[model samples]
Target: MKTYDEKHIKNVVLVGSAKSGKTTLAETMLFEAGLINRRGTVEDKSTISDYHEIEHERGNSVYATSLHTEWRDYKINLIDTPGLDDFIGEVASSIRVCDTAVMLLNAQYGVEVGTELLWDYIDRYQKPTIIAVNQLDSDKANFSQTIEEAKKFFGPAVTVMQYPLNAGLNFNCIIDLLKMTMYKFPAEGGKPEKLPIPDSEKGTADQLHNELVEKAAENDERLMELYFEKGNLDEDELREGLKIGMMKHQVFPVFCLAAKKDMGSGRLMGFIDNVAPSSVDMPAELLENGKEAPCDPKGPTRLFIFKTLVEPHLGKLSFFKVISGEVSVGQEFTNEKTSTVERLNQLFIADGKNRNAVDKLKAGDIGCTLKLKNSYTNHTLNFKGASGSIAPIKFPHPKVRVAIIARNKQDDEKLSEVLSEIHMEDPTIEVEYNRELKQVILHGQGELHLSLTKWRLENIYKMQVEFIKARIPYRETIQKAANSSYRHKKQSGGAGQFGEVFMKIEPYFDGMAPLKEFPVRDTETHELAWGGKLVFNNCIVGGVIDARFIPSILKGVMEKMHEGPLTGSYVRDIRVSVYDGKMHPVDSNDISFKIAGMMAFKEAFHQAEPQLLEPVYDVETTVPDEMMGDVMTELQSRRSIITGMDNRSGFQVIKSRTPLAELDKYFSVLRNISQGRAKVSIEFAEYAPVPGELQRKLTEEHQKELATESH
Candidate 1:
């Protein structure tokens, strides 16, 4: 395939909900462009985009695949992305690099939760977009109804550019409203036959044409005046106005297609070539030197790594978009983030499993470079002496966590390395060691996402891992004030250890209530007494306790602060006061004082009100109204408290607070309840005290486990 410069290149990402035929549409486009002689079907596992083993087994796209096709003298670099919410990271990365987004909607399903989510992301990035109503040949497809749904969810900017000639299985042709002509295709393709609109459909076609003209005119004041004065617009004027409006995101042209039948695929391609913005039409690259540099191939090199893939055999492949200047093989660029220079070797354009070598890559072109020393997704590459780095794309933090352990000891070391490489490829995925639980956790958007990563670990990296339930990070704290004393005495050999400590434990509730001595005034006014401070006073005026032992007692108290009496977990928000103590001159030592401090703290903590704190999460769920009741009931069962609910367009937005532990398996439950119509986002909210009985049980279990582990 011939390469195109920035002016002729169009980077578009195909995005939408699951099973929306986004991959099929990409396949059809490739076929129509003559990139592939015979079109590969999704079910047969022969399609170029869905090439992964898991994708073929599931018959859906599992990751984003970049494919380039030449059509109408333009190079369309299409990134076909997975629609499932689990793999949204791929969609996000694709959106970050693409100049435009083409959202594919299943004609039968119309707009869906994932479609809305992708729309929001596009809006957030302020990228121009086009909506393609696909699967028109499906039995339940309805073009008009789908258009209405699109307009309702995406606003009135969704103007129909083409109207289907027929619905369902008879859908073989479409009327181009802008051109005011109808094109029909034969059962087997050569080229679509252009014909005048049929008498019966001419009236509807004319109405659609008028709507398109009016929408286009509204984008420009002069055009609107001319349209109102002449009751029409010239074809050239209309096209120019619509193009400008689309670039500004004031208008979104909707086209219909049956990707499976390859109908309207050529027309869709033509529209993209004519309407989509080229690299120059899009925004200029913001260089690291705090300057808005034009997309000039002759300028200094500046590329952004938007995606990374780690293949066990092939090593790490870093996919980047050249924002400024040109990059060639054997040339080195500095990674501004890490201050490391990496050489570009074997520059290649990715098309699923195939990589076509290219001698040089220009600005606005997406290509891959292998075996970079310190390059990963979101890293900005530039020439030396660049003042600042380009801002990285922000992705949502992973809210869901799953504990994963190597299935066998043999895979442990390999699992660690594989997980690190995977995390590097997708920054949204996080792997961390939970010190308290003694487990390695893999966190992501949902269960399926983590599961897929595990599958890749085994199949792609040859590392076996087991997914286990994650443990909640619980904390312990005191509820009230209590005082206790402990004496440590031991006599064995010539020298013995002896220490005595009198300590007081109290709840430290800052900004909650007045201190015991302050009453309603500020604690500063009553310096002698305060609620939050841990006071250590030397009251051994008569030499009852040795002064040398005071520091040891405080050290012992500090060590006891880590594990509370209520649970074998870190304790917080408590004050410990060491008032007085006694010690023998020769026997007094740090070890004896430390033991006394631990005993006194345990007794005092029990005397005070002890409680366990569990992590809470703020959750937002978007679901259809019909499924609201079910979702609410499930949340209630999980001990969630509904904070608010609002109607957002046709969907219900539910905001609630749920314990993190309760939401561990929420992704699967939500899928089952909403039938995959719901999308949820969650973040850490705060920590709240757990109930008394549950806290007691958890504390006992934790203590027993710790004892067993120590033994």
Candidate 2:
């Protein structure tokens, strides 16, 4: 309802481990800002941030919620994101557009696995961050210990800005080193009474204050010179220095807060309003042409969609950050990625699930609009024929996969439509129709992620679906060369079918010349659909077989390649030369030659020592040093070859090469082994030969399946 300039706007995101009171802190902030009359708790599932039904059922945030508050004339756009790493896309989207990130640490547990995982993205974006060690009222709260861990994990930049005098139970009083005053909040938790530091705690407070001053001054040259001359920085100078330090990621100020009780939030808000860097202070955004564009309201209109949510009644709610210029309602802009013009029919700033309609969104601000065709998350909307677009976000790859099918076959068609909608909302849920595997595979972060997807399908879409381990796409290739011939002669009635084919097969390699032992006219090559190459060198000598029947022969060979004879898998990497063949004048039709070529290729493939190639993955796992031995031992048992090991900040990163077949449901096993303190990412590597013993077993299983089908 009020207009704010870029200098008065602050885009912030609250991120940390689960149950760290981020949602409660947001609720308290909204309440204090006069946006809400009352604060809602997570136990009742009535908090503004965790308003979704699934979030209520899970008692935690499952998606990011957008909300804003006006604190002391500054508009703070706060996005509360999910703490579960499974839904990291939400966190990533929030970080992409935010100017600052407030990382909440649970005082009891200190730095956790989730916190460590989130640091990578925060570092990637290089956003200015503040550490708020929360839940100081709990019995297990250990502010000192938590700060020590934070410094150890996050580095020396985690400087102290506040210290709790009495943390647990009696956590109302805190000494603010930034302002050099002690704040004592009432038991009711409204406003705090600022008082001078007591004589008993003056020495400790002064020491901490000096450390804060030094940390701030070290980030800026002017401040460093002033500090060396005057022995300290004034209040205004300290804030200016801190702002510079924050933007450069040279300092991470830690504050104390009992968020649920609404203590210490007022001080935090004050700091954000007075010192946090604005969009103008940030570096210029890089465009598609590698040109930096400043945040100028007079420049071309550009908005980057960071997140998208599709509701029951609301079609598509797109959350975007205006990168340049002002966009009034009904203004049309070109979708840089799609090259299509889209009009913003209406613009609204998100308030949880509700919207506050705005006439215009200015540069360096976050807002949302609905129902834009041909636009989704990560798409940048700019003026027509603009020079460039904003870079796209790189989402993490899915770590777990399952083949899904509709329980009720009628819902199968509906399943695809709903899946597309889900994918639009959450890119982490990968749904693919793998023709080679003959199944639709759903890839997600872990089992919980897929379980939630199934729930949504059953409850929201009214569809029945089943999740099963996806079949690995194995390959079949040959090891040696062989020549074989077959004659297909079928005579039952008056007419007869007769054709003979002689083919020499050898393993194909890139840049190798096709077999030219005999004179040939045409050389046809086909790239196999899955992988490798297929070359047919027509070495038929003279007029042994008709040239017209050559395609038919190649087609027959492809049919066998589509479903290999050894294990029913796709075949690749082989050169076939039809050096010799026999055909009858009246009986040698396309069918006869095709059958003869298929039979001859199968015979030669079996004789050439056909081998099975299993898909392998390059896996990287980061675990605590105490659990590294256990994790490596477990991985070895799963037939994983350890590639390398490196150490990082009390953690171990182990890289390995493991077969995909051995990785089915491996995420759960990895988590269990490390007690949820480990993270893993797997990517497809080159296919390797299956072990001889496993190959024999797989062949036997294939034969049994064939026999059952025949019966």
Q: List, residue by residue over 264-284, the lDDT tens digit for candidate 2.
A: 887888888898877767888
In model 1, what lDDT does residue 451 have? 79
List, residue by residue over 1-711, the lDDT tens digit for candidate 1: 465788888899999898889888888888888988988989899998998888888888888999988898988999999988888889988997898898888999888876766776798777888899998888999888888888888888898889888878877788999888888877654368899999999889889899899989988999999998999998888887788888888888988788888888788788778878877787776655657866777777888899988765788888888887888888878888888888887899888888999998888899987889788898888875344567677777786899998889887887787788788889878999877657898889888888788888878877767899988877777778898999999999999989888877777755544334311211111112211234333344555666666667766765666655666666666766666678887998889988998888889989898888888899999998899999999999998999999987678999999998799789899999998889998987887989778887887887898799899
Off by over 4 Å in 2: 186-190, 199-204, 332-334, 338-345, 383-388, 490-498, 506-529, 533-552, 575-578, 584-594, 624-637, 642-647, 652-654, 669-675, 700-711
Shift in Å, residue 114, candidate 1? 2.0
Cα deviation at 42, candidate 2, in Å, is 1.5
Clashes of each: 1, 0
For model 2, what is the C-alpha lDDT against the true structure?
0.87
Q: Compared to the true structure, candidate 2 yields what TM-score? A: 0.89
List the pairs of residues colliding in candidate 2: none
